[model samples]
Target: MGLIHLPTELILLILPPLSESDLAHLLRVHWSLYDIILPYLYRRHLQGSRDSTGNGRNEAKGFFRCIVTSNTAGVQRFLDFGADVNAVISAAEIRKANFRSTGFIPWHDTQTPLNIAASMGDDTLVSLLLNHGASVTGSRNHQDARRAVQPAAVDALLSNHESTLRLLLRRASPLSAPNMERGGLLNCAIARGNLPLLRMLVNEFGADLNATWQEGVYPLNRAVVSSGPEAAEIVRFMLDKGADAALANGGSSNSNGDEESTGGGSQRLLDQAIRHGTIDTLRLILGRGVVDPAIQPLDTGNNIFRTWIIERCTPETVHLLHEHGYFRALDSSQDDTLMIAVRARRGDILQLFINSGVVVDLNARLTRGGSTLLHAAVVRCKPVREAQAASSIRCTTMPSPVASSDVPTVRKIEPEYSREVLSRRCMSEKVEKCAPEEIVRCLVRGGADVNTKDARGISPLDLAEKGPEVVYRILVDSRCE
Candidate 1:
């Protein structure tokens, strides 16, 4: 007779010798065995029956298994049999057991069973645990190492479990708690770009608007950097709800001076949006007119114009800043915009600065280094090999023919590599000498002091000698000897 046909009493005797994995597999084979095995598994723990090896290694495994697998019936049965609802799973215990590593659990730390259920977004298990006196605030059994309610809610949010997070909020004092003071939950929602969750937190729960999500990261700031279609909408919604665009949180947690200088709020939001965010995000922040575009943070060397130039923002972005009176603020500021432009090898940006009616000092020395626009223009030339490699990378490879008949005629089979090689050679020739010759001519005609030596005592003409012959010739003809 098969094990399924065995008497209940005989199966009960057999269960003690079988591993938990074997019991689980046996439970799946027959409904009668499932009933016989599951209750035995839970009852043994309650009865304090150690394994054959004389250890309580399987102590909390059944209870935790019920939670992780979302086995609501098993969880209810275990709890009904007076199981400890707040059972904590240590990392060591978890490692020794044959539990599924779902990756959401804090595998390195001790966590109550509720933490796992909440993180998994199993609302039925969470409700059961909470009803059975599971602390929404987490149990402090392991002292300061407790992982409970707050992290659970945050985890639910990170898992994008809207219903689970909302359920946890009802039982827990989320808004008033010390852990929620930084708006961790709200920030997580914002970071996730969950518009419905964000609205539910703010509109129903009354979460703090300006509360920093993390050190130096406010809700508005976080929304500005988030991706997805919902990100822009979130930004607009927060601004409409009276979020402070200029609110500076306590500086960043790390040693990144840029975040510290920008105050990690609206300023950093604007800076980051310009550098990496979508144009819609950039315009949304700019439309508010709250973050002053002209105020150069301490990290950008106190140069207002240096912000986007060093960031390598597109010329169109620069144009947007110009339209917003950003360039207008540079009149009182002492940043050498022209020299910065030239050094970045941005000839188009150099012309844009001149076209914008912004006065630039052609002869202004970049610090005591004595590097003028002419010196910057020639010294920062794109190397020939670097340009060639860039061109090659930009070119796509030709796809191979599938069969002899599929091969193209000579005219159709014009190898893309040939075009790529020619393109690379042309680019190599362009940058081989020095910086763009147009940049050299522009600086010379603008009356840049080509004869002026840098701190290294090298003049523009001297720097151009080994560069493109055109650049050396331009300096020579400009009477920069």
Candidate 2:
């Protein structure tokens, strides 16, 4: 009798001793052999058993490969053969094997079959595994003692696998599970700027809009910093749905220390909105009237206008804040807006302030070192001045004359670049290099005292002498009397 004439019972007996590669080859041999071998092959490989060499891990990997490939029948067959629906695979093991199936496991977490399936965005496999008694609760990472259960729903949410998430949510109560454990799913959606997912989680699944999403953050705060076309839309949706605009970005009363006691943290929402959000988002938050834009809270450590917003925010954002009276509270302090503009080398912003009728008190000492505005301007321009001097020295022999209009001057500088910007920016472009000469001249023309000395008895001209020769000449001919 030929090998094809072998009985099914005999084939089953012979298959147990065969290697995986041989079984795979045999599976393609004949249709009759395929049915008999397929079940035995999956059953043998997916027994969910382990050994020292990680053969069981390879088996689990093969099973997950079927899930990723959308081989529903293969997955179903493995489950029928008594594979653990909640087979825990360490992220380390998956990583070591260099496993990738067109899509990655969302969290790189220790995961069950459902976690990987849900991340694949295949609701079919998710349903199949859930029916096979897969635990909807999260899997614990045994690799780390302090690591918490990484919820399967987070994997789906992070991947934007909405249908798969809906299936998992049906089997798992999102709130009771680890979905809301650390960084809540609602906040995750906000950070991703997925307004549809944000709406579904809140409207359908009851994810709290004002809930403490992260340790020290609320969803609205997350939405503010989350940049995308949908970011402002998400903020508006959250506020419209009753997210408390006045709730501190620092979360509950305990997070703000005494700010909640004195109603100080509420004022920072406008500041954060201006610093990080678009004009529309700023308008939305300002429209709430939760915090007064004109009133600078005394307890807030840093003034908003004095911060990097001049160098970081858009002209529109700066204008919106100005329209709301952000610069109205400027005082004779080191941290005033004009002094900050000089220190940051923001010629455009300085011009904007000057045109807006904001007084520039040039002789007033305005830096921590007790340097006047002129001293701050010259000191901050040192690096650029040195670089320019080196460039001029290198090109002196070749002295290529150019048209004045071709050069970027203070009058032509555009306000761009930021301190902690959300948009993509080239690091080569810096605020300090933008119209350094014009910044100095503007203060000088505004009657900056050339003879004014700082608390250290160091005058602006004295500081310029240590720098390149160009700085000294500029100060020597200062328009100031």
| lDDT by residue for model 2 (1-481), tens | 7666799988898888888899889989898889899888777676635556643443466676676678898788788876767667666556555555344533644566777787778888888888888767665543332345556777787778888777777776364334444466776677666789888888888888766644556677777754456667898898889886656543244554433424444455666666556566777666666557445632134564446676665555566566666565444652467766776777777767666665646577656677777887777656665677777878446668975652121111112335444442211133343666678777776667767899989898888777656667778887333
Off by over 4 Å in 2: 1-10, 24-35, 52-59, 95-105, 141-149, 175-182, 213-216, 249-266, 274-280, 294-316, 329-335, 360-432, 444-481
Which ranges of candidate 1 are over 4 A from the true structure? 1-38, 46-59, 90-110, 140-151, 180-183, 212-217, 225-229, 249-279, 293-301, 304-312, 329-333, 359-372, 379-466, 473-481
lDDT of 1 at 196: 89
TM match of model 2 to true structure = 0.73
**Per-candidate alpha-carbon RMSD to the true structure:** 11.9, 9.6
lDDT of 1 by residue, 1-481 (tens): 9988888988888888888788889899989888888888778765663456654333457677777778899888888876767666665565556454544444225556777787688888888888898876655333334443344676566666778888988886355344541356777677666788889889988888787645556677777765455666898899888786655423343455333334424356666665445556667777876456556442235465354443366566666666776665232136666666666566766666667666556666766687777887887654566668778889687998876562121111111234333331101223212247788887787667778887888898888876777778888888943
Error in Å for residue 418 of model 2: 15
